[model samples]
Target: MPFTIKCPLDNLYGMHVFSRLPLHEAKVRYLVEEKVPSMHAMIELRSGEKVRIHFVHPAPPSPTENDESTERDAELVIVARSVADSDEPVIVTGDLNDVAWSPTTRLFRKISGLLDPRVGRGFYSTFHADYRLLRWPLDHLFHSHHFTLTSITRLPSIGSDHFPLLTRVVFAPSQGQDQEPLRPDGDDRSWAQDIAQSKNANKQDVP
Candidate 1:
C-alpha cells in the first residue's frame, strides 16, 4: 500500500506522520520554521470509519528553545481546541516535549476531553534513548472515548534521542461509549481560553 509522509516543507525539525491509510485534509501547523510542526489529517480505515489524527512536536523548554514554554503551551492549547471541536474519533500522538504528568499535558487532556491510557499505568518514558536513568515520557497519545487501548509500549531505541512509542487501540464505540473524558474545570477553561485566544500563529499551516 502507498503511504504518505506529512511534514513541514524543507524543515528538518517539523513533526512527521507516516500513514498507509488514505489520508485527507492533511495540514501542518508551526509557530517557528526551525521547530517541529504540528500535522493533522483524517484517515479512512478499512471499515470505512474516519479517524482524525494530529501529530505534534513543540519546542522543548530549554534555554535555547521555547524558554518558559509559552509557545509550547500555546501550541498545545490550539491543538486541544481543535481536537475538542472535532466530531470524529480522534487520536493525537506526538513528542510533546513535555512530561506526561506535567500541568501543561494535564491541561491538554482536560481541554481536549481526551482519555489517556497512561493513567494507572506506569510512566512509559521514551526520552534519552541512550540514558535510561534520565528518561521521560515526552511522547504521548491521547484519544477520544470511542476506542479502547489494546496495548501501549515504549519500544527499543531507533537511533534517536527518544525511544519509539508503540500503541494499539481498538475501535469499539459500544465498549467505550460509557467512558467519560476528563472535564476541564473553571480554572482550566480560563487558562485554555487565555492560551487559545491570545496566541497568534507565527507561521501559516502547510498544505
Candidate 2:
C-alpha cells in the first residue's frame, strides 16, 4: 500500500497545518475549483534557508460525494506539476485521499519528484481511529531530497476519525546533492493530462 485508503468526507471543508517558525511567504492555491485549495507556505529557518511547503486536502471520492476520483486526481496532478517546477526544499503533504501504493499517488510522487519517508518504513496507518482493524494510512507527507528525516510517527487520536501525524527533518543540502528524484513514464503523463483536462485544464477523455 503506497499508503492510504478511500472514504466519505465527514467534513468536506476541513484540514489545517500549523507551524511555530516564521513564515517568509504564504498563499492559498486553488485546485480545480477556488473552494478546493491547497496552502503553499515558505518558512525561513534560523539558518537562513527557506523550505517550501504545500499542504493539500483534496476531497475524497465517495458515493455521496465526488463519486468519481476525477477532481481529486486532478487536484493532485495540478499540485504535483507545480511542485515539480519549483526549485526549493519542498514538502507536499496532507490527506491525499488515495492510497500511497495506488497508481494515482505513485504518479503524483513521480511527477513531483518528492521522496516518501515511508518507502521502507512501517505504514503508520492513520484512519478510522475508532476501529484499529479498519485503519489505513490515508494521510501523507512527502518532501524533497534537501532534508533528512529525523522522525515520523502517528499520534494518538484526539477524538477525530483520523490520527494526527508528527514529523521532524533537518535540512542538509549535501544530502539532496546525491539523491535522484522520481520521474513519471509516458502512460503516467497521458493519464495525468487526461484527468486534468477532464476537469480544469483542457477537455479530453476522462480517466
Candidate 3:
C-alpha cells in the first residue's frame, strides 16, 4: 500500500509500503482523508486481527508563525481516538517534533489510551545527532495496550539529523487487560476541543 499526496500538496513527504506479508492475505485501508500531510494505514492480518499504523510528520514550531502545533496535535488526537475507540490495535510512529514529556504528547496518550513503551525505559532521543546536550526523544512509537514491548533500540546514524528507532512489539490481547489505560480528564478534553476549533487550524506543511 504505497501512499502519495499529489502535485498540489508537498509530494516529497509521502509514505511508502514495504511489508513482507503476502499482499493477498493482508488488506490495507486508509483511515485519514484530511489535508494534513500524514498517512494512516489499517491492515487486517491473515488471522483477521486489525492493526492501525499512522505515520505523522507534524509541523515544527516556527518563530514567525503562531504555534499551530496544538492544532496539529488535536488533529492527531482525533485520529487516535477513532482507532482507540475500536477493537483494533493501533501503533502511531513519527517525528512529532515534540518531546515525550510535553503536554501535547501527554494529551495524545490520554485521548488515545495508547501506551508509551519507553515509560519505564530510558529516553531514546533521536534529534540533533551532533548535539550531545540538546537532544530529546522527538521520534516516537506509541502503541495500544494490546501490544507488549519486546525490544526498542535507537539505531546508529545514517548521516541524518535524527537517528532511526527500531522497535519490536508483539500483539497480546490477553495482556491488555492487565495494563492500566490512560484517560483524558475534563480539562484535557476541553483543551483539545479548543485547539481543534482554533481559527488558525488550517492545513499547514508537515515536516
TM-score of each: 0.90, 0.87, 0.79
lDDT of 3 by residue, 52-160 (tens): 7767766566664325566457556665556556666888888887899988888888877888899888999999888889988999998887899999999998998
lDDT of 2 by residue, 127-203 (tens): 88999689888899998989888899899889989899887778987876776667888888788878887886532
* Model 2 whole-model lDDT (C-alpha atoms): 0.76
Off by over 4 Å in 1: 8-12, 31-35, 201-207
Tens digits of lDDT, candidate 1, 67-154: 5777778778877876777667998888888998789999999988999988888899998899968988898999899899999988
Better of 2 and 3 by TM-score: 2
Of 2 and 3, the candidate ranking higher by lDDT: 2
Task: Report how far residue 150 has shifted in candidate 2, in Å.
Answer: 1.1
Assess each prediction's global lDDT (C-alpha) against the native.
Answer: 0.79, 0.76, 0.68
lDDT value, candidate 1, whole model: 0.79
**For model 1, the run of ten residues with the poorest summed lDDT:** 198-207
Per-residue lDDT, model 2, residue 89, is 88
Looking at model 2, residue 182 earns an lDDT score of 72
Clashes of each: 1, 6, 0
